[model samples]
Every structure is written in C-alpha cells, then in structure tokens.
Target: MRGDTSPADGDKLGREAPIPRQLQQVQDDDLDPDSVKRHEEDDDDDDDADEGRDEEVAGLVPRLSDEEERSARRARNEGGAKLGRATTTYREGDDDYDDEDHLNHVEDGGGSRSPFADRREQRARRRKPAGVLATIWAIAREALPTLAISVLSLVFSGELLIHLARWPVFVKVDKLFILVPILLNLKGNLEGNLSLRMSTSANIGELDIRRTRETLIFGNLALLQVQALIVSLFAGILASVLGVIGGLGGASEGPKTAQRRGFGALLTKRRVIHHHPAPSDPSMRLRNSYFEFVLVIATGMLAASMSSAILGSFMCALVVVTRQLGGNPDNIASPLAGSLGDLLTLTILGLLGSFLVRFEGTILATLILLALAAACACCFFLAYRNAYVRELLSSGWIPLVVAMFISSGAGLVLDAFVQRYEGFALLVPVATGLPGACSAIFVSRISTALHSGKGVSSSLSHSSSSTLISALRDILKLGPTEGWIVPATLFTIGAGIEVLFLVLVWVTGQMSFGWPFAITFVITSGLIVAASLYISHLITLFLWSRDYDPDIYCLPYVTSLIDVIGQILLVVAFATATVLGDQITAAVNDHQKP
Candidate 1:
C-alpha cells in the first residue's frame, strides 16, 4: 500500500523528502499519559482488530503525503473507537525545506535538535543489511581493481628488454635465484605486521595512544630484526662450510664462491612477511614489547655472524643503536605523531640495510633471517597459549602478522642456503611464492576449520553468517546513504591499479636495467606510498560520513601486492643492469664504424 503513492509537489521523490529530522518528531514530543493508560486496559475482539490496524500504521513511513496522512488518521481512529476512546489525538505539520533551518538545527544555534542526532539515525539506517548475495557481490566487485592490477603487472613490466640486454649477468647471477623472493617476502611481512598491529589496536581501545603502545611495538620490531640477523649468522656458517667443501672438490669455484658470497651479501633485506604485534589488551600488549625486544637481539647477532665477518662488529653496533634508540619513548609515538620520527627511523634502517647489502653474503643473511623468524614463531605460540595475550591480540591482524613473520623468516633462511649452494638468484620469485602461498594457505585452513561443524557449534557459525546476511539485507532495503563508499571504493581501486602497475614494471624486467630500472623503482615506490595515504584518507573521510569498518581484511592483500612488486623490482634491477658495460661498448663500437 505504501508503494502505491506517487511523488508529491515540493517533494523530490514522494511527499516532502524528510531531511531525517522531521521523521522523529513524534518521539521528541511528550505523550498524553492518561490516553495511553486507558488504551492499555481495553480487551475487546474489536480492540484486537484495531490493534492489527494500528500495527499496519506503524509500518508506514513517517514522512507521508496527504493521501497517507488521511489513511493513517483513519486507521488510528478505527483502532481507538474499538477501545472506547473519545478520539485519537494527532497532529500533522509540513516541514518547510530550508537550508538555513537545517544548518541551524545542525549547528546548535537552534536547540531543537543536536546535529549528531540526525547523523546517528542516518548511520543506523545505512548499517542495516542488504542481503548475502548483495554483500558478496559488492565485495567481489570491489576486488576487481585489485585483480586487474595483478594482471596488468604480470603483463607490462618490460623485463624482456632488460633480460635480453643482460644475458651474461643473468648467467653469472642465476645461481643466487632465491634473492628476489626473499626481499618480497620481507616487505610483505613487514607491512603485514604493521597492518596486524593496526587492526588489533582498533579492536581494543588502544589504536590511538601517545606513548605506551608505540614503545611496545617498536621494541617488538627491533627484537624481530635482531632475531633475523642471528638466524642469518647461523645460515651463513652452514653456507660457508658447503662452499668450502664444493671449492675443494674442484668444481667451477667461481660460481660456487659467487653463490656463497651473494648468499651472504643479501642478508640486510626487507622481508615480505613482517609481524606487528597488535595491542589488544594491556597484558599481551605489554608482553609483546619484551618479546619483540628479545627477538631483535637474537636476530641481530645471528645475521651479523652469517653475513660478514668484516662488518660483524659494525652490524652489531647498528643493532644496539637501533634497539636503544627504538626503545626511547619519544622515538615511537602514536601513529599520528610527527613524520619526523618515522623519517628518522627509516633513514637509520635504510643506512644499516645499505651497509649490509654492500658487504653481506646470502648465506649469512639467510641464517640471521631464519633465526629471527624462529623467535617470532616462538613468541606467537607462547602468547597464543596464554589467555590474556590471546584475548588482546586475537583479532584480524594476528593471523596475517604471524603468517608473514614466520614465512619471511623461513624464506630468508632458505634463500641463504639456496644462494650458497645453488647459485640461483631466486629472491624475487620466491618472495612472491613462499609467504603468499603459505599465508593464503594458512588463512584458508583456519577459516575452514573455524567454519566447519566438527569443532565449533554448527548453529553458532550459521547464526553468525545469517545475522550478517540479514543485516546486509536490511541495509539494502533502506535507500542508499550519502555516497561515501563511492570515493573510498574508488580509492581502493586506484591504489590497487597502481600496485599492479608497479608489479608489472618489476616483472617486465625494467627493474634490472640501469636508468629504466631506477625510473621504474621510483615510480613504483611513489605509487605504493601515495596509494596507502590515499586509502587511509578516504577511509577516514568515509567513516565520518558513515560507519565503515576499517579492518585488516585489505591490509594483507595490499602488502602481498607490494611484496610481489618489490621483489620483482629487485630481481629485474640486478638482472638487467649487469650488462650495461656491454651495451655501452657495443653502441660505441657501432657509432665509431659509422
């Protein structure tokens, strides 16, 4: 019956398009208590029929046309007379659509309504469910840009040109093939850790803090870093022994030695899967601080030993500096603190990484990386067993963070061994494979296990899904809210596209060549950083407009994309630029002959 009405004059759609405020006028007004008391005493069959009619009236939209107005009034009258009431007391008034009036109501200039009240009501309307199919469809549609970016990156990275130019270099470096994958894994791991921490923080009330939480997170990172270094040290020793044995066997020692050296050199790397301990509650939050610190110390020692005996002391000093500096309360502030701190931290870390890359070997690097990884695993398991930590950090961030840290640590260790023994530069590719595959596998398994009827109650799982679906259905049934998801969704898509392009450049062999590689790297890096900022800005903006859950769901996916691209870039960079001399020589020779 409500659907039969046509749009009224001065109304955009139907009746006067009530600007939300007018719809709640009844609730705001005082009710006649004596009239309500008398209606509660009625018990006639006619009263029951009138009650049904009154229920129907309640279903009608509060904003009405003259037609709806008469119908509701008639319904109320019939319902009331059956209860022996004199008449139903009601009033109908038209709200003039005035910008000034709306502004005043919203600004507190008019005490009639608080600005937040109408906005809250609108949000409640928006959050109602649209349905399962709609929700799934929306999610899938939203992911299209992400999928497109992946495809594009795979296609257009311009790597063929670089590969063709640097064949000999590829030949020379082919033995250390594990390097690319290792780097990508590290990047993803680190980013994933950050996301996990963010998500976990969001779940608790600690997402925004000035000091305590930041110190803990920084300490954890340092610990993880140190543990990685320690692991690399052990790996390097093993690699050296194998290299020495192979050299003595009289094989092409050039390749063997190179493999060992390269393996050791690639120690100071960015891992794809990094873990960030989320501060869920005070206890686990506090515990992670100490745990992460321990991990960093262990990793640092391992990596230093493995990578370079020459710079071992320097590397240790760097770790100590990082640990001490990172622990400073001022160094690690709330996420919103000055970019100066982050810039400083980045500079210090980058310097250390550069130093390590210049002198470190793959075998040593891998050992330290693995050692740190083991520490991360131990920390996670220990905390998981404890109820307090589990409760605190057990949100969307933990799974991804844990998966990334452990996988990255494992990848680095394996990469070191691979480089030392195999002379295959598998870094970029392996980074894409190991952490991506393993994390996805782990997530899938966990989701399945949790959803399966054997362990958990089937009814509970079903109920939860059903509730979500129902909520979505209700949301869809309500008209759309102010178009906030539009811009947010667009930003997500744009970032995802940029990510794919970055990956493409890395994969297409642009990363290996001299100038082209450099250009590609800059472009890719800028896009990633920009995209992240844009997403954060848009999400925050949308949240102000409507209640949108900024969860870790997108973080892993984004980090994975970044990791893949970063590793691909590193591999291409090394592979393409190695033959720069040859290219220049050939060009010069041709020019001279002409």
Candidate 2:
C-alpha cells in the first residue's frame, strides 16, 4: 500500500469516495499540480480555438448560446471533459465522473448539493433507527461485561483502601495515605485521557490500519509513562509538604512522634495528628525528616511506574480488541480506567512501600530514586520526539492539577459522612463512577465528532458564548441530528447498571436498602447523570472554543466534577435515607411480625 503512489491508489485503500483534488495534489503533487495548472488555463485556449474554428467552419456554424458553445468546445478539445459541468460528464479508463458528480459538483464558483449527497441523506433517513440500535447493541455487549468487572474492581478498591490505611506501612509512613487521593486522581486523568484518545482514533479508523496503529499505540504509551512519572513525583512531594505541616502542628501541641492521617483527613484540612516513635538506630532518625520524604517519593514513583505500564498496556489492548470486534471502546474504556486505577495503584503502593521501607536507611533507596528520575527523563525525551504526543505533553498538566484540587472537596465530604452512614464506602464507587462513565461516553463521542475534517462533525462545530447555559442550549439542538441517542443510551445503561448493583448488594446482605434508599438513589443518580452530561458537554465546548483538545482535558474535569457532585449527592442521599429508611424498615419488620 505504501508503494502505491497514483491518484487511483487512494481509492483502492477504501478512503472516502471522490478523493479531493487537494489530496490528489498531495499524493501526486509534481504531476497533478502541473496538469491542474494547465487545466485551469484551458478557458483562454478554448477561446482561441473557438475563434479559429469559427473562421474555418463559418459556413457550417449554427447559432448557439455561450454556455452551449463552451460545453461543445470542452467535449471537442478534451474527450474526458464533461459535456456539461452541471449535468453530464465523460469517463475514460480509470477517470470516471463519479468523483466529480459526488463531491465536486459545481454550479458556479461554489459547488451545489450533489445528487450523491441527496441520495445519502435519504438513505440515512431510512436507516437511522437501525444504525442507532445496532450501535447501542454493540455498546451493551462491550460495556456490560467490562462495567461489571470495573464495578467489582472499585468495590475491591474501596475495601482495599480501608485495609491499606490500617496496614503497617501506611500506619507508620503516614504520608503514603495523603498520597492516595492525589496520585490516584492524577493517574485516572492520565489513563482516561489515553482511553478517550484511542477510542477517537478507532472511531476515525486510524487504528484499523497496522502502521498507524503501531505509531499511535507506541506514542500514547510513551506519553503515558512521562505523565505517570511526573504525577507520581508530584504526589510524593505534596505528601511530604503536608507531612511537614502536620509535624509542625503536632510539635506545637506536644512532643509527639509525627502521626500520619488518611487522604480524607489530610486533604479535607482537618487537624493533623503526628505521633512519631523514637528511632531505635542512629540511621532511623530519618523517620520524620527528609529521608522519609525521599523514601515516600521513591516508593510512589516505583508503584506509579509499574501501575502505568500495566494499566496502559491493558487499555491499549482493550481498545484495539473492542474496535476489532465491532464494539465501542468509548463505552467501556474510561469506566474501567477509573475503576481499576485505584485498586492497582494501591496494591502496588502498599507492597512496594513496605518492601522499600526495609531498606530505607541504606543507599539502595537513594539509588532507586535517582534511577527513576533518569528513566523518567529518558521517557520525556522519547515522548517529545513523537509527533502525536508532543502537543499533548504541553497542554494537559493544568487539568490534572485542577482535577486534584476539585477532588479534595470530595475528600472533605467523604471524611464528614463516612462515619455517619452505614456502608457509605461501598456506595461511593457507583455513585461517582457510573455518572462519570456516562458522561465520559458523551465526551468521547463529541470529541470524535469535533475532530473530523467534514461531515456531521463540521456541522456540530460553531462559535458560541462560553457559558454552560449557552452550551446547553446549543447541545439541545443536537436532538434532531440523532446526537442525543449517544447520551441517552449511555445514561440508560448506567442507570440499569446502578440498579443491578443495588440489587446485588441487597441480595448479598452487604448493605440493607429500604424503599426510601431506593428512591433517594434513583433520584440522586439520575440528577448526577444529567448534570454530568451537561457539564461535560460544556467543558468540551469551552476547551475546544479556546483551541484546547477535548480528548485531553475533558475527562479529567468531568470525572473530578462528577466525584464532587456524586459525593455531595451521596451525602445528601444518605442523610435523607437515615431519616426515612429507618421508618420504612421498622414498618416492614412490624408487618412481618404481625
């Protein structure tokens, strides 16, 4: 395919029909441009030829309109030229009129609507329902299994966090707890961005071809490694700073060993309690000092490095397989990324931190940190050299920071209500995850639409005021275009999944749910889903309007916003349920007793 170099070769490759002369020039510039330039000068030559022909055949000449004369001359001078640019054309060898008829149909300086476009519009009208149904079916097949797995994974992540918080390494090295929310938040952003980008490429057919697939996949992985390294280091540094602040607070209160706190306590701005034990060895004096800080940073980098390598590869493979299987990765990828990021990161963190702590006083820890730094520096250069990811490296940092800060608010809600509600931790994942995934699907579809060269995507892009209400009014116009189907289907699936998860928990006796809880959940989830979709749409348009790529910035902002909204909503739902849920449960029990 690469060896093929002619205009006809593009047709063989199954590119969109009617290759534009612009692309023709790109493929065969020297030959096609020279010919096209000469062809543009044909009117003068035709005039001269007409003058000579008139003199030679004056006796045989018949009166004709100027339009008819031009048509006749075109037919005579060029056998392959159309007899009438508007109605008729000639075909010779590979040179067919199909391209001109379908794509380049012209009435004057501007092209009129082609008959092909009309036929396409009619066919689309006929097949619209079937198309949407088929896509929804495919989405269900891909999404359901992955979502089940992801939801289960998040459940385990929540449980794991509870255990991990109490684990010796985390209890002793309290900064690690503070690192959880920050690093996981940043990692999700990195991976979600990767998944969305890959899904976009798949939708546009970039991943269908082997060469492009390899380039994109490799570039994305490199870019991911660069991002992971940076975020992990940042997490470690932030944790250390917080650790120092807590140490100072604890010192002023009493002569206590520096005590570490959970992500909820630290990020929520609660009073930090540090209770450090006396170091047994001279080398162990580093416990509350820079040595512990460097050690935490080192462990985070290792854990993050490993997690990104594992998760990034999985996401790439999942996207490729989904695309190959005629499924939509956009529906499944982000959800899994969010669901799995915390579990995997913490698993790596707890194990790696404990292992590294054993050698903390030795030179191995310092070497490991230095080595990770060098490796990350090398990855940065590698990603920089990649054309696809170069622009991305410079642009996405702001969203990660913003998302992290926004997530801290969620941490505050979590800390306050976590002790107040039964099984509150279990509900957190579904509350936040389902709504975020629903909106992520919308963002993925819209990003794909915005990146196209022409067609419906072009129709969707326009200048609008940067306001959520303006964006909402603009997006509301998409209903007539079948654009609403994507969000509708995604939300429908999400709600169904949310209900199923509730049933499963009820059956398993993991959490008791009454009529009031059900009503509150349905309302809260629905409200969050609606808000997530509109806000994500607003963010995407706002970024795109300012020349930011939605694929990079949208998901992080959307997920962070959803988490905040979801947490607040969860707290409200639980508060309401605590009142009504108890009464309903008591009434049901009394009826059974009677």
Candidate 3:
C-alpha cells in the first residue's frame, strides 16, 4: 500500500459493519423489482428537499426571517371563509354557495340548535299504514257523480223550482239559484287552469311568473270560457224551444210560436238541462293529445259553471289570490312579464267562471269536471316522464305532498273547532287555503335551491352509496343540518299554507247557508281532497321513477293530472251536495204534508 491508506483499504475500514440480514436479503433479492426502485426514489426525495429549503430561504424576511406570518394569514383567511360559508348556509336558504359570494362576518358564533326534532315523532308514526280499502273508496267515488247529477237535475226541473219558489226562503233568494251553475264551472275551470300551468312548469322548468307562461295558462282557460259561453247560449236556446213545444198541446206547439217566443222566452219557462261527457272517454283511445287538453278544459269550465256563483266566487278568489304564492321567485319569466301575467290569467279565469256558471246545470257540469281531471292526469304523467318537465315540478311537489299528509286531519279538526261556537266556518278558506298555497311556494323554493348547487353540490358521486351511509351516521348523531334543513323548512311552510286556505274557505262559507250549499261544499271539499291525493301520488310516482335524478322531468304530468282532477272533483262535489240537499228537502216536505 502507498503512504496514505489505499482507497480499498479505507473502504474496508469505513464499511466495517456488515449490512443487517433483512437489508442484505432485500439487496440480494431480484424477485421484487420495486425494492431497487424505492432505493432510487429516496435519492430523488433528498434532491427535492434541498430545492425546497432554498426556496424557503429566499422567501424569508430580510431581517426577521419569519415564515410563520404568511402561513398564519393564509390559515386565517381559509378559516374565515369556511365559517362564513357555514353561517350563510344556515340562515339565508337561497342559492349562495360560493365562498366569494358570502358576506364577511365576525368570528365563529355559538353552536347551533337542531331544526328537525319536531318531526321525530311524526316519522315514527309513519311506518307503513295498514292497507286501506282503496278500490272500494274509488268505486264509491265513481258512482257519486251520476247519482248526484240526476238528483240535482230533478230538483232544478221547472216543476221543482216553481214548487220551491212558493216557500218564503226561496221567494227571497231565487236569484241565488243562478249562482249554483256559476260556481260549479268556476271551480272546475280554475283548477284545470292551475293544473295546466303547474304541469307545463314541471315539464320544462319554463312555467314561471313570466308573461308568456302566464298567458299560456290564462289563454287556455280563456278559450274554455269562450266555449262555456257558447255552450250556455246553446243550452238556453234549446231549453226555450223545448219549453215552447211542451207549452203547446201536442202538435199545436209548432216552430212558428217557438220562433216568435224567441229562445229567451222559452228558456225562462223550462228548466234548462245540460249534458256532459263521462269521465272515461267514449273512445278511450289516445288521440291528438293537444286536442284532448282543449276538450278537457272546455268540459271542465262547462261542468263547474253549474254550481252556485257564491261557491264559484270562493273558488276563483282562492285561485286568483293564491297563484302568486305558488310560484318560484327565482324562475325567470319566459318572455312573459311577471305578476301582471298572473293577474291577466286571474281575470280570464274569472270571466270564464262567470259565463260557465251562468247557464250550465249541475248534472251536465259534473262530467266536464271528471273529463278535466282525467285530462290533467294524463298531461301531468306525460310531462313528468318528459326529461324537461320533471326538473321543473321536482322543485316543489315533493315537499308539498309530505306536508299535506302530515297536517291533514289535525288542521281540519282545528278548523272545525274554531268555526263551531260562533258559526265562523267562513274563515276556513283563509286559514287553510292560504297556508297550503304558501307551502307550494316554499317547496318550489327548496327544489330550486337544490338545483342551484348552493349548500352542497347536488350531484351524487360514484361513491355516493358509501357517502350516504356516512352521512346517515352523522345525521343520527348530529341531527339535520344545512342540506336537510332546506327540505324540513319547505315541508313546514307547505303545511302552514294549506291550513290557511282551509280556514279561508271555511270563513267564506259561513256568510251563506242553504242546505244545498252546505251539502255541496262538504261533498266538494272531500272530493277535492281525494282527487288531489290521487293526482299527487301519480306525480310522485312519476318523479321517483326518474330515480330522484333532479335532471329528469316528471312534475308536469302529475300536476296537470291533479289540476284537472281537482277542478272536476270540485264541480262534482258541489253537484252531489246540491242533489243531497234537494232530496232531503223533498223528503221533509212530503213528511210534513202527510
């Protein structure tokens, strides 16, 4: 060896300790190519660490050499942003999700309280109800219209009206008889209009407070009104001709005298009889969809017109007043102006109501109602299945239905109690109908919120199943927070709205009380509720069929169906009541005479 230790000798001295058995084995093995690659990766990590250290040194303050300050500032900003987002989400339920969109607030406040505890008991109570006799109920409802119509027609026959006019009550209130037809038509037409608009909205997300949308809704009803006017005029003429014919002794009643009397002369003498189509179409085949809609609207208007004007007025007022309450404030008007369009619609519906009720009789009117209901249901189903409509309807209906079922008997009972002592049932419409309308509005808001990607991105991820499980656990422990709170609020608001409307209707009823009116209103309300439930369920099924995919369309079909049915039921219900009242009156009179 040279004077300095040779390289081999130094290496031997420095590498005196042999590598451990595990390390030796790793180094020796060629089985795992990754072991050798990992060793190479360690060297790259060392190089990166050196570069990172240089960057840190360069960024250091000249004198203070402080890095912590910049880090702290970043932390504070992020924390502040997160807190603001959380706060904003809890309060303003609108679509304001972006961190930058938030209003800056102070430091984190106190812990929040749960908003959904009120429904815990309710949820527990909703475990699948026992099987109801739905078919029996449905059949009973089906037969009700014919029974009611025949009875009502018989009561309003020229002979009965004459007999009734002899009574003191009838002598003073004879003018009120015209109201029966007016109201019957109003209820059917308005409900049909509502269903059409809602269905269109649900189908395309296009049904807004916009002038165009409102016009579409209003225009259709206006046409129906025109149809009603023509129908009534025709009916009046026919009745007059018949009256003149019957007035003459057999063949002596000829065309010349009928013409001289004019249609008006005979109309005043004979009881007017109107004929309406049945619920199930005679053809029962799918024809031109649009044509059917037009027919249904016309029929519904015609049918509802047969009810008393007082009832029609109540129905129209409820619709006109509450329509805005059912709309989504966020919806962009579809080239149509806003509330003005709704006003125009109300005006149209009102005009149609006036005409329909003026001449149509109860028996003929009920058919129009059933036809409308069927038409609406079909439309709703179509729209719900349509990809576009499902998106629109989804935003509102789910919450509305839930709220209705929850508060049903409870709110109605309360309303009954309120009206019992002082005969204040007239307030029922305001109390019940208003809240129901409001609920519709709020539920709409909630659906729009979810669509907005505000609180949480609405899209379910690929791993959503796992995430859902995690979320459920979190919910069980912590209660409903941001996302869930939206639904809860919507549900409550809907319930409140419905309750208000019921109260309003009740209050309005107290102002006038004829046995016919009473019987008709009760029957009409029950029918209305039943039809609403049926249509609502159909809509729900349509919506869920899309697998809760908000992107799908389904609401329009259900809403249309409900709207049509609701209108039809309103007319039928009123007609039934009228018939029941007449029969009772006749029975009482016969008993007194005996």
The best candidate by lDDT is 2
Per-prediction TM-score, please? 0.29, 0.72, 0.27
What is the TM-score ranking, best to worst? 2, 1, 3
Evaluate all candidate structures by whole-model CA lDDT and list the values in order: 0.33, 0.69, 0.33
Local accuracy of candidate 1 as per-residue lDDT tens digits, 1-594: 221334563265434533322223434444456544443443233344344445324431112332333334344333422221112121111011123444333222122323433453455456766665564355345234323433333332223322322343222222122222232233333333333333233222121222223333443344334433433333333333443354357353444345655654454232223434333533224222332222223333432323222222222233233223322111111111111112222233323333433323234445545555676566555444432224334344443444455456544543444333211232343223222322221222222222121222122223323455554444344321223342234334434444455455456543232465445435544444344433333322222122222233433443444353445444443344443431211222223242
**TM-score of predicted structure 2:** 0.72
Q: What tens-digit string does per-residue lDDT give for candidate 2 at 295-413?
A: 89999999999999999999999988777665667777877887788889999999999898777667777888899989888888877765567667787899899999999999888
- State, as a TM-score between 0 and 1, how close model 1 is to the true structure: 0.29
Cα-based lDDT at residue 275, candidate 2 = 52
What does candidate 3's lDDT look like per residue over 1-594, in tens digits? 112335566488564332332345456776467875654454344444345434434432111111232222233233321111122111122122222212111111111111221133245356454233442343233223322332223223323433433443222222223222232222323333243334323322223223223334443343333333433333333333433345454342323333544764555455335333334532223222332223334432443333212232333333333333442231211111111222233334334434543333333444655665565455455444333223343343343333323333333343334322222223332222322232222223333333322222222221234454554343234311133333333333333333344344345442333566555545455444444433333333223223343212223233334334444444453445545653212222233242
Off by over 4 Å in 3: 1-387, 390-419, 456-546, 549-594
